[model samples]
Target: MWVLTSQFSRNLTSHSSLLSYLPDVKVGKTTDTGKFWDPHFDIHFCYKPNMKWSVLFVLGVLSWGNTLATMVPKEATFYQLDCPKEGTLQYFMLKRSGQAMMVDNTYKVMEQNITIHSNGSIIFHSLKVEFEGTHLCVMNHPDNSIHGHEVKLRVRPLPPTDLWGAVYESMFVTGLIAALVIAFIFALGCFVYKKQWRPRPEDEKPVMSGYENPAMNPSDDGESGSTNM
Candidate 1:
């Protein structure tokens, strides 16, 4: 029987905001026809906390097995396991002694914060600071099929809230100042335009009285008035 083991690590620092980490581990086994076996799996984790923190562990199966067609086809069966906690999975608190403990349906050391999903996958959650050290996952089959994987978890400290808050407040104040400056400039431009505005000139009309008409000469009117006098 050939044994396969694969190891991988997923960093939770990438998701610091959410304070959640999900490790992706895949395990599978194949058997010939007329072979019956039960598979067993276990996960091991170690955590030391600088301060008080909480964590959760969840377990589920992704795919059971696939059938192979041949002269004698092998049958594949899928099984689902329940989560460690009965109802809502609670977080396991890690104390100052650098020890992590969880209270749940299962009394196992690392099984406390576990939750089993419909699909078989294990999820571990805790504060970034509280997660440290090496984690191991073991899968065993009755037919001597054993697979193992190693995961190293590392978490970085979150940025100080006061610093981030100050940055946000500064940015908001800067934006407000910029908006006020823009509005003032706009109002000044409108005021200047109104002050500099001038009215357009209208067309002039010619005087057209009986004597002032162009057809009646001013000298003829003067001679007639002199002759009448």
Candidate 2:
């Protein structure tokens, strides 16, 4: 009878040990994979196919949108817009105000000069304080597809006494002085050439006396005496 009691106690302890090793199973919910869900936590963990690719696609779109924005310099003489040259494209520049105006590439719009370069870059010349606003660069492809790039231009007035202003003034003065010096030197050289090449009258020939004239035949006297002897 003691052996039977000890055997029962050993069997009970082995069963308890086995149960402790097993995971705690809840009766709240079961997933499609036959896994039991915890009741306390409301989180649902599932594998989404192509999740990495979806995240990468979202980030690529964000980066592509950022690439379409441009910033113009505040104190620049010109602003350049580099467009993609993948297809036959027509370029258009638009000024955005209360109403959008198509920027003309003519002298009629002298203040806002536009130039299309050999490359696919559009140049906006003579940036002015009035041009401080939003601008759009539109490219129309052969397939009727349109792509737009936006620009925010702000042109600040250059100070009269700034370092760059001083430098420009000094350069202008130096250039003016150099030009004047070159002009003066060229004029002096032209004057000297004219004077040196001027036509002058020839000097008059000196008249010789009869004694100084070899053609008078002074040796004829000695020849006549020898003949007389």
The candidate scoring highest on TM-score is 2
Compute the lDDT for candidate 2. 0.57
Task: Enumerate residue pairs that collide in model 2.
Answer: none
RMSD of 1: 29.1
- What C-alpha lDDT do the candidate models reach, one value each? 0.39, 0.57
Tens digit of per-residue lDDT, candidate 1, span 21-93: 2234322343453222224322223233423222221111212222112212111211122223222322232
| Candidate 1, superposed: residue stretches over 4 Å from native | 1-112, 116-120, 164-229
Alpha-carbon deviation at 114 in model 1, angstroms = 3.8
Q: Distance from true position, residue 88, model 1, in Å?
A: 24
Model 2's TM-score against the true structure: 0.29
Cα lDDT of model 2 by residue, 99-190, tens digit? 32333333224456666553456566766666666565566666788777665656666556588889988999999999999999999999
What's the lDDT for residue 32 in model 2? 85
How many collisions per candidate?
Answer: 8, 0
